[model samples]
Target: MGAARSRILLDNDTGIDDALALAYLAACEHVEIVAVTSSPGNVDAEAVAANNRALLALCGQPAVPVLIGARQPLRVALVTTPETHGPQGVGYATLPAPPGPGEESLDAIDFWIEAARAEPGELIALFTAPLTNFALALRREPRLPWLLGKVVIMGGAFYHQGNTTPTAEWNTHVDPHAAAEVFAAYSAAAEAGLDTEKLPILCSLDTTERFEMRPELLTDLAAAAHCTAPEIVSEADPSGTRSGASNPLVRYLSDALRFYFEFHRDYDQGYIAHVHDFFAAGIAAGTMEHRTRAATVAVETESPLLIGTTVADFRGLWGKAANAHVVSWNDPDAGFAELVDRLGALARQLDPMG
Candidate 1:
């Protein structure tokens, strides 16, 4: 018998990496993306909604609903990453406008609550951006932690340098208050008898940085794209001068990576880019193996210098029970191999041969 497919609700900011993560999820055969909720982070809420719609259409899943969420952080001024993800949040990837407007009946928080209530213990909530929507949802439905089947988040940093500040990652740093609220609410939910085994799972910078998108992976993906969808490659090539060097997916990723790779190269002293959210999606879809450590994690929201820092209590310093599972380690070689395999699968799914 085939493995069971997981129902996932993806919350994203729809930047370059988020777009790649969306492609990964859409291509994954064992994942049923129940809904997509967008919030302001890498870009504004409107851009995120547009990106979600366009990416879904490009991936042949235009039927999926795209709901707009929070326009700003819960308790701070809006911070955006135009330098990294380009002004439109998707770099040079030109996508068509959404066919229709967003769902009018329910907003992002409402959509999350309704979906979770409908599915009970069968919905996986995947967050790849700031936690504003999640914090708001938890506030409206305090029992959400108990209702969700699982929660996979791509944020935080442990034993690694921060991407936004000296002490914090971008997603958490953008909305430390929301991150704090989320962690605290999950802890409270556990105290109220929620299952401990299904506590929030975190794929932090500590683990994701290990799996970088090197040139070889890009070459392999481009080759796969050519084999599965030569028409897409032709369209992407446009001038027909590149000799079928790229496909739609490869072109989109390459265009985005032009900026992303430069950012890492100049700032982090690396030529490769890491799709951090892809790891979170993989964890949610059960496509990758990882090693985790049970730790009591608390987001720092008070200190100006340390705000959004993930304070992991590896030692029993506060006498608090572990509230989250931190993915501290993973084999990069194997993980990237699986990722390439999945990307190839997605290419075929998006554009099947005649």
Candidate 2:
């Protein structure tokens, strides 16, 4: 009949950008989201699950299963960011309650193992959160590295100053031990003769921070929303007192980004926000223009001063073979344009009433 849609299993922590990434994927026509697994990072696991369910419902994909994952990092105490993502992890955006509680039959780590076993070389695992679930799965099933089609992760701060610590990004910083375990496991698997093509691809802050969502992009997106879903704009404000944005997807994103924008302005001295996880999802979908360099990456697990630091050995300092494809840079103009176009297209596809 038609070309098969790419199968993906998304593991996220349901932060604001993660929620945006989920909505972006739900609107994509060429990818089929098999399931979503949540973990604790920006928010707790239970709240993350709830956010995923609520966001999916708002996007009209209420049927997509949301599975709760680890309540905390593998070995470290729980660290959350209510200050960054607001109390609910979605800023001021208020979504309807999910239709029901998420699937409770299996743990998220188990689900990852079973899905990989069932699909073998056909499942694309996208990790946009801490790696506790992945580390646990790999511990339980060592063959997991060779069984998946590909692994794309969004973490680390290579070549750029860290967001959480002087040398660590938030995701990796939240669970450095788990992150170390995952990178080392995949490297060991490759050395043991598993195909090299299945190695993990990392989208780090070095590239993601280059592409910021400026006010003009948001304005254009709102305009596109107005053209696509006029009714949503009307409903948002019946009296027309507010800036009309008809697309629920755009409205949701715009609302959630208000807080993020403020954070960037204060922290980074910029008025725009970086959509970090969205770039990772784009890399997984092969829709972003990027430049990569193969490197031997190791996460610092023991040093307190450098905990969660992604030590990318581009100079062969460690005498280890390269195990990860690191995205050194991305074309900011092309990336921003593609992201805006994709978002607008999704808004139109999901809400064609305007």
Each prediction's TM-score versus the true structure: 0.92, 0.92
Error of 1 at 19 (Å): 1.1
Q: lDDT (CA) for every model shown?
A: 0.81, 0.81
Quality of model 1 by C-alpha lDDT: 0.81
The clash count for each model shown is 0, 1
- In candidate 1, stretches whose alpha carbon ends up further than 4 angstroms from where it belongs are 1-3, 227-246
lDDT of 2 by residue, 1-354 (tens): 122467889999888889888887776678788888988998898888889988888777888888875788988898998777878887656678876666744588888899899989999899999998899889999999888998999999888999999889999999999999999997898789877688898989998787687656767776665564332222123221233366777777867776676667667557677889888887777677777888889999888899999989888888887788898878778767776777788777778884
lDDT of 1 at 291: 76
| Candidate 1 TM-score, C-alpha based | 0.92
Candidate 2, 207: how far from true, in Å? Answer: 0.8
* The 10-residue segment with the lowest total lDDT in model 1: 231-240
